[model samples]
Target: MTLKFGDPDLEGLKFLQDDPLVITPIIGNCHVMRVLVDNGAFVDILFHNTFIRMGYNDSQLTPSDAPIYGFNHMECKVKGAIQLAIIIGEEPREATQMLNFQVVKAASTYNAIIGRTGIHTFKVVPSTYHMVLKFPTRNSVGEARGDHKMAHSFYVITLRPDRTGGQPAEDLVPIPFDPLDPEKVTYIGASLDKPLKDRIKTFLQENNDAFTWTVAKMPGIDPNLITHRLKVDPTRKAVKKKKRTYAPDRLEAIKKEVEKLLEARFIEEVQFPEWLANPVMVKKANGKWMMCIDFTDLNDACTKNCYPYQGLIP
Candidate 1:
């Protein structure tokens, strides 16, 4: 599905909204907590709390060092991106998907945003309206362990104009959305199972206010702005800076670090328990352990946040 701007034409857009884009808060390097995925943001991570918590007091971020933007549509300061581990999918059948997210600093509850900047690096095709992510698998179907097949695959919303003619006038901008308001959110995930997709579509249809946001953290803009631009980093220029040392420590510390790094050679990521989806059990299957989350009654009772979106609120 695709979305187009300017003039009325239903054939030009497939309005897949970014409902509840899979937002994950990952804890890495101890005391480092931030949201791993925030679909709205094109680039730049704002981590006001993270920097404070990490004991980097009185240090200001460099805005010109690297261009950063926010929901307010203002120039934002960007710190560097540190790697983090984010558990993908729901419990029982869940798997660990290591991702490299920008260490964003923000004064809001929206910690560490894994923007499209990081997502585009991987194989992702998003069906925004359905709230489903179509990502690719890493390992081949044969050598795959357990039910795991896909690598780190995340999808994005593409506003494609309708190939079929004869329809109503459509919005000439990217789908409008409110990240703060629970009601205005578009749900995104791995699948659009019948029940889930129906629930999502019902929500979108019922709430005409539901739309997508291209520039997260920006405030106040014409609702019709469709010429959205994502921050683009020249891969060639960035790679010119040769790799830096991990940490200068004792030989013993260095050896241990090296070994640990080697073990995680396949994926550059961090590890944690809370990231595990299902309730872990004691077992050994083909020299591997079973990890899963029991998302039974817990999800039903989960309460929404308190912040009501400023403009989105009727």
Candidate 2:
């Protein structure tokens, strides 16, 4: 009864939240994290600052047995087993895979979490009078781009240069922002006649498919179900904040040989899809292709919020 963002609720696509709840995780091959399908959330994850840029070390965190809520509910304080690997829903399936290692953090963003004590051992189902959320087809995983693919969620268009007196407006400007790195879509303006940077490099070499979209209307809440609250920013005491400026054996040797320029190495250390820092790979056979980046220097050092394509368009 509260899902508005482009409009299209024919009873929430004929009530289908039974499985395929929008979850993603793929560490070495890359896809990092795309969480949504919360199974009741008890204490599944919390890593934030990109898990310290992924080498995680709050003095080698170790303090959780289970229990650390604080999204305003207040309780905070946890540091338990975080070995890794919850791969989920697809890939050489072995019960959709599991090996939490020992993740323990209540509030999230560190790029790791799947709470409800592990979504109540996979039996989570929720519709909320058609808000949508259900996962229980033998603990569903893989092949679930459900809800017409979350109604196409990948917004971020920041291209500006509609100058008025400063001189710089040859027809190339558009703005839209969300950018949590959902498969990417950040243009931040200024390609001049470069034509929206050639239509954002042909929308990442045509993969997000025509990037074809028309659903306009998102201010807050319900872009296909949203639940938020996560913060962990007040550092400098985890051993004097790791003795000054990030180090955990230098990010574990930069995450054990950081040489994965993404071949679908979908970059995911807390969603690095800020476009791409090393994108430029090309290889394909039956299933493989490259060209995915639009981070644009962390969206030009962040801070320009978008939304300026209103009134008319062809």
Model 2 TM-score (2 dp): 0.20
- In terms of TM-score, the best-performing candidate is 1
Model 1, range 1-314, lDDT digits (tens) per residue? 22222233223233322233344333444423324344566763637567557544434433335556644566644455544444433343233445544445434434555567645643344433333444444431111011111111111111211223233233222222444554554444434476875666667656754344332323445548754433332231211122234323333454554455455452254563222222323234344333223432332223322222422321
Residue 72 in candidate 2 has what lDDT?
48
- Tell me model 2's lDDT, rounded to 2 decimals: 0.41
Model 1 CA deviation exceeding 4 Å by range = 1-18, 25-40, 44-46, 51-64, 85-87, 90-104, 139-314
Among these predictions, the greatest lDDT belongs to 2
Candidate 2 weakest ten by summed lDDT: 235-244
Clashes of 2: 20
RMSD score of candidate 2 (Å): 24.1
Worst 10 residues of 1 by lDDT: 142-151
C-alpha TM-scores of all predictions? 0.31, 0.20
The parts of candidate 2 lying over 4 Å away from their true place are: 1-17, 22-33, 40-42, 46-50, 54-56, 60-62, 65-111, 117-125, 128-314
lDDT of each structure? 0.39, 0.41
